[model samples]
Target: MIAVMLEILGSALLGLGLAAAAAVLLAHRLPARRLVLLAGGIGALLGAYVTHEALGPGHVLVTLLGSLGVSAVVVSLLLRPAAQAAAPAPAHRAVP
Candidate 1:
């Protein structure tokens, strides 16, 4: 049903969003942008899968795998690159 599909997709998107936020929080201490990006992607994937499984009517394995894959791809492509690019700005000092 369309409703079911919508629910699943919506949940997945929400999860992905949350994961990106979490990753940003974790990124603060991390030195490697790649690692942060990767971590964010993983977090997003987990979020998407959990969201989908909680709302969708599917087998546990299917739900987990499907959501994980979907979330991973979406978050990795959409969020990871962008997040990784953001670096702390250097403090400006007065010119001698």
Candidate 2:
């Protein structure tokens, strides 16, 4: 009961922290800040809930770790690839 609640709270905090770090470190690669934060927080919460249900109580550390992993994956999916410059078209040669 209480343990479960604590796990949820902890997982959510961890998720938010991870999102903030990602946003700061990879601002160019990530989407909007709000979206990243939302995805990370929700993903972690969902992960924690699922893990807790599957593993049951007495496994708080494992559950939190699982939640963090899930949150990271969710945030990573939102990342955009680095932009590349377009190549110029080759000049055509005139035939004699």
Candidate 1's residue-wise lDDT over 1-96, tens digit each?
A: 664555456545545554556467646444455554554456545655565557666454455455555555544444333356767999999999
In angstroms, give how far residue 24 of model 2 lies from its true place. 0.4
How far residue 19's Cα lies from its native spot in candidate 2, in Å, is 0.4
- Model 2, 3-67: lDDT tens digits are 98899999999999999999999999998999999999999998898889899999999999999
> lDDT at 18 for candidate 2?
97
Instruction: Give per-model TM-scores.
Output: 0.33, 0.89
Query: Which run of 10 residues does model 1 get worst, by summed lDDT?
Result: 74-83
Question: Which stretches of candidate 2 lie above 4 Å from their native place?
Answer: 91-96
Indicate the residue-level lDDT of 27 in model 1: 60
Best by lDDT: 2
